[model samples]
Target chain A: MDDRLVTAGLHEPGLAVHVEDLTVSYHSKPVLWDIDFDIPPGVMAAIVGPNGAGKSTLIKSILDLVRPTAGHVTIHGLPYRDQRRKVGYVPQRSSVDWDFPTTALDVVTMGLYGQLGWLRRPGRKDKDRARAALARVGMEDYADRQISQLSGGQQQRVFIARALVQEADVYFLDEPMAGVDATTERTIVKILHGLRDAGKTVIVVHHDLQTVRTYFDWLVMLNVRVIAQGPVAETYTAENLRRAYGGQIALLDSAATLTPVD
Target chain B: MLDILSDFTLQNVMIGATLLGIISGVLGTFAVLRKQSLLGDTLSHAALPGICIGFLVAGTRSLPFILTGALLAGAAAALVVVFLTRTTRLKTDASLGIALSVFFALGIVLLTMIQNQGNAAQGGLDSFLFGQAAAILRSDLYVMGAITLTAVALVTGLWKEFKLISFDPSYARTLGLPVLALEVLLTTMIALAVVVGLQMVGVILMAAMIIAPAVAARQWTNKLGVMAALSALFGVVSGLVGSVISASATGLSTGPLIVLAASVIVVTSLVFAPETGLLPTALRVRRDKFSLKSRLVLGTIYRLAAEHGDPAYPAEQAMIDAFHRTDTSAVLSRLEQRGLVRSTAHHPEPTPHWVLTPKGLEQAQTPLDQSGETQ
Candidate 1:
């Protein structure tokens, strides 16, 4: 991990997603600073962090949703734009308008909208694919239901199904379990594991520290910078967690209104 | 009504109003769904200055020139909204309000100046404030129809793009969908929708045309395509109905009449439509409350019976009341009618003893089982 910390060039064939010297800022204040990591293919990895830790920023920068100050991201040994079709992204559910008059199927169909291109519409084949994706997430029964009518857990499942319809080699989920029920969390973890089993890389911006060892095989501890990266058993240590959280844990605990973590 | 068709002025007004309705209604769906209903209001208000500038430059009330000016002004207003929000700490709603008021204030000043000048050609320019549908000329109808057609064509050609951006622009951008371009396109279309209706609906009431039909239609459907179509239908109907009524009534401006009609439709839809309508939702809440009370009563009775080791042991009303805070007599009677519970005390007494029937006992176990399973 120390040797690979240097700015790696694009097309690192051994790595699924490679980011180096990735710094992102909102207006001049740096949100993510000098981030570096290489996620191996077929591993279920979690990007863990405290509040304002730039966990979401790291993923957004890698996905080109937010431009990095000075860095490059490669997906499967290629530039992200070149392999855009090979990647899938599920944003935070709260970031969208849930009352946008779309059904579960319609939202999932958007996963194929990129392939459908500019003027073309999704057809029966695309609908079937969306339906199958819904079934994969155990939400086939809700395919026709309006998105706003769905519960938080059901909404999360529909979002996952949408990403599933993309069928990319790698998937990025941003807080997929935030505000979700226990059943939903288990269902999502199972889906992530299924993706890993199918030889797909799954990256999630997760908050629950208790589920760290249980849910992910690999972990990246971030706090505007990469604290450590490797298998959860090795890199996710009490010392590293203290380094990443440390005094902030006390501050976070005091602010009980924020999501509590162990 | 027959006289209105025969009268060229009435005929022109009807056509213009109908076209504006359809265009605004179609575009308004995206506005409402995107949670940019306020943006529609802002853009329409911003178009006023454009209308004045068009009249000033052309020195005549040519529909095309006025509409072009309105379109440009409206687009500029949208840009200001984006610029203000991005550059400063002002949120979108605040920026929209600022832009709307500034542009509208400037427009009023220009309109006042134009009216003061008293040019013969500018006789009907003030009508743009509260549009005079009767003043709609044949040429104006052609212009309105053309604008409506362009709007329809653009929406049809870019249906997927619009839907994507409206629902989730960030995800669309991640997919390399050119989100900024799509956003600009939608803003421009909304501006265009506003500009085209600036004559018949008037700037003051134009936003309502854009939003009201969409709001009404949203109450009836969950599909974007259906919502758009239904909104268009509602818009068209409102326009026709408003124009007909206005033609019959003297001293009524068609713009406000059309807006009022659309508002009526929105109110009616919100109140009476199935599913999302207020009435049905209220009824469902009532029904659910009744059922919930019944479940509580039955569950309490089942518990009492279980404790006694006799399913048929009649539980006293005082005991059931202790478990439920609300009055339980209505629910008890409903349960008895359903044959789920029977009154052990045949006499009508305030403190009657009740016991669950076999069906009630079986059903009462569901809530308990559900609670256990949830854990």
Candidate 2:
């Protein structure tokens, strides 16, 4: 194992995420169209877009979960393969079968797998970190509960806890607050803020527009286009929201624009 | 069972049962984990055509040829599943159903074709339908043992990868795990287990070998590690008990006997095992619901009382106010019955101080935990 817990002093400046002309597809049908961007360190960024606007696909493309048909993604200036342990991913809640038999603690410990490398077992340190991660989300007491026993908010918290245990510099969360209870949503925002304050960049695929002001500083409003990306206060104007959800379908836009982005 | 294990025939039966048990126990865990228990059954039946084809091509009983045939057939079945899922609007379970019927029907056709030929090589062909492990040659046992060993090692080596992919494939891919390759590898290993054990355990009842123990052991544990270990132990016992019973009996098939024994274990676990067993789960559900109802009553009163100045309400004549309950009489009766409050005929107004009793408060204060909570 590398045992390089803190990469701050060792890493070079200028890049956290580098997506160059990335074009991903599902069975040859293009989902992400030539996404090109560079995210600097420590910004709490939002990929705000309408549903099926390739928000999830873009995140997956970066993780190598959904391989791009064209272009590439480099995390910490290295391929996902090279920096496997450097990037932590919090997928949509629907990604897993909650009915699976596992504890919250057990699920969070899975984050250590990338660092554990292979056949070697998770030791006391892994368990300790996993517990701490759960505590970070106020779920330490619920660590022993079956994952299925959690409410939508608690489930999202457990997943954030899992990602937290990874201790990666670049955190990508896909709709972490979707369907989450209000308390969980607030806790997730606080945790992300902490991550950003610690010099770790957190990119969230957020659906809520109302909270975008309070939740993030950097915004990338999208609607099959890069609408804007900068400080939330500067870019989250009525114009940007309109562009992301589209003005053509004002009815569809009305309901979507009201989402609590923060 | 002890006396039967002492007999030479029973002893052979015991060894065969143990080997079959091992194969099923190990492979069945993956089957259940993948939610392909029925698929295992389909592949078991699908292996028959391979056996018949193996006999046809080699003109003799060749374990390797038979196994290869079975493997190909199972692979074919899996391919069919993938193809259906990809090409059509058919859902996964629907695709699985189609694969099961098509593959099993093909096997049945092949078996009938071979039997119609009337070759002496067909003598033991029917045995494949319901295995006679006592008639198993030393070479056959060695073949099965080697395959079982390989399957076990493969599972161990890929344990983390399999768990990662099976539990959350999208995350596994993000972590740079080979999701597709791992899926294919696990499927191949499962298919091989079904192919190898089908001859000894038989086609029809072989899924029991793969699923029964895993399902049964699930009652005893919630952790994947513990469940896998218990499943293996249950499988071994199912094998051992089934073998001994068959060994001691006359004109009884070892395969059916073993399957029956394993089924017995599953039944016992389902009904009697503590904690997550069916009976316990049902009891817990009722208890939780009752508590929830009691809490709802108190919570409603608290909210309503806080909103209003006093706890008093019109007695007997009004509907359950603010309860959303259509019948106020039902609500008052239950509350009065529980002695949380009472109504007087002299006053049309209900009793004041509608506060929770000690028991009532306890139920209302219970923390709500989702069934999906992790331990």
Candidate 3:
């Protein structure tokens, strides 16, 4: 890591992402309770947990889309809103209807929309950047293709490409590969790893155990509570797997949920 | 025919048809993709009160005021949908029904109230109940054209944003899209299309104007761009034909005629188009059935040959007894025609037995792995 990257980790270590005594409630029920953690800048981390683990809630609370009942979340010593553009988010597949009219390339162009603010059109340079992003995901051929025609893996790649086009420092994806085939799953993992290599912070809400050790540098075990958050080498363990996947239903179901974040 | 183009009235009607076609096609694309076909209906019905109110309040036959009211009320309907989805436990269907019924009934009551006053403005307002394409003045046509052009430009220009949010909203958000704002913009666009179309098709026919072309085009193409363009063409053609037919006779309502033309296109597309069409798909299914029987017979022959290390299996009696689970007559007849098996009425086991020739063996060997994957 360069001095800039190193200095970023130290001087803003406390400023990185300070969740001071954060608690979140939904419909009168506490989903995330009094959580405190510091996320160093420019590191990829996986938030792993069982169903209803409040993994997505923690992220939404940080984004201010969800209100925290107690405490506050800050980014680089600034309020989340102050650094809103710096953070990019990817939701699970079910978040939007696929039959929507836009093509894959059109979707990637939306990354520039944040900076464009509103009502202002994307210029030639913006179009070039969108095309470049599509090429990066090897989806340039399908750029003009309707999103519905693409398979699960192809769709996920298009989404990741859109996030990359944002040029934001922080990226968050929620259950990106819930029902993708193996090849696509592998390609997505490789791309996410590449993002981390490029000195960006990547946080994924993941359920798989196998890929955590190899794919993620940092791991967060959440089960309506923060089970652990640290280096995968130290935090991801057999005990943690059991802790995360409580009340085992069956091997296949657990394995399906256990799809690695990479 | 060439001189008709020179005629101002004919020119205005033609221009009106083209504008309505383009607007409905563009908006209806989103409607169909979103599975909100009924939403188009709801907005159209809701526009009636807006048109009536515009007439009563303004006390003039101004297109702008009537359309403005329609646009605002259409947005109100969209907001109601959003509110129902966000705040209440009531489903979208129930809320749409409520909005459609309440707004339409209020519009009827308002229309009646305005009628009781017996004002001249109400004369034009009644025309809005069912669209009067002939009543579309040159000024009204230009306004409609501008809105149509705006819709076309926005949809094509911001194709990326529209696509990302519609296909996969969550992913669009991660890339920093303002999901809520974009959603509102799309709904507003749909409303604007309805507003622009209200004059040409009338409020009652406006919903079909958006939906019919879209439905017809979907039967022809899967790609959004192609579907949108085809839908626009279908709409323009239907509008033009309906207008011509209505002009040909007395007591002919252009709205119903236009809808009938669009419906005819829809029916033809459903039955004839290659992909999702009924006729082609049925033929394809039949072809597949024949191929499936052939494959099954080939499989049995190869399996029997492999088991016995012989080219032939026992006669038809043995086949009927062994593979009685399925109807084996087709397989037997097919094998005999291919000259891959031999059976005749000559011996004690008189039925010719099934066998695999070299060609049959080759055919069966391939695609078994493929079959497993498919199954």
Which candidate tops TM-score?
1
Q: Report the lDDT tens digits of candidate 2 across residue range A49-85.
A: 8877799888877777666788877677666676877
Each model's lDDT comes to 0.87, 0.76, 0.76
Q: Give me the iRMSD of candidate 2, please.
A: 1.5
lDDT of 3 by residue, A1-262 (tens): 2454445443244545777778997667899987877777667888888788898888888877677989887776666665667787776676666665567877777777778754567788988899998887778899888778898878888877877888877788888767888887887888788887887788888877666767788877887777777887777766666766777636535654566534
> What TM value does chain B of candidate 1 have?
0.88
Compared with the real two-chain complex, what DockQ does model 3 have?
Answer: 0.32
Residue by residue across A27-97, what tens digits does model 1's lDDT show? 89999998889999999999998899999888888888888888888888778887778899999999987
DockQ comparison, 1 vs 3, better candidate: 1
Give me the chain B TM-score of candidate 3.
Answer: 0.83
CAPRI class assigned to model 2: medium
Which digits, one per residue and each the tens of the lDDT, describe model 2 over residues B1-375?
556557776666566667677767877886787787887877777777777788788887776777788888888888888899888779778888888787778778888888888877777777778876777766677777887888888778777777778788888877777788888887787787776567667877888889999898878877887887788788889787777666666777778877888889999998878976789889778766654554555566655544665444322333235454544445545666776555544344553324445554444445556322121
lDDT score, candidate 2, position B206: 85
Span of ten consecutive residues with least summed lDDT in model 1 chain A: A253-262
Q: What residue runs in model 1 are displaced by over 4 Å at the alpha carbon? A: A1-10, A248-262, B292-375
TM-scores for all candidates?
Answer: 0.87, 0.81, 0.79
Contacts from the true interface found in each model, as a fraction, amount to 0.87, 0.69, 0.38
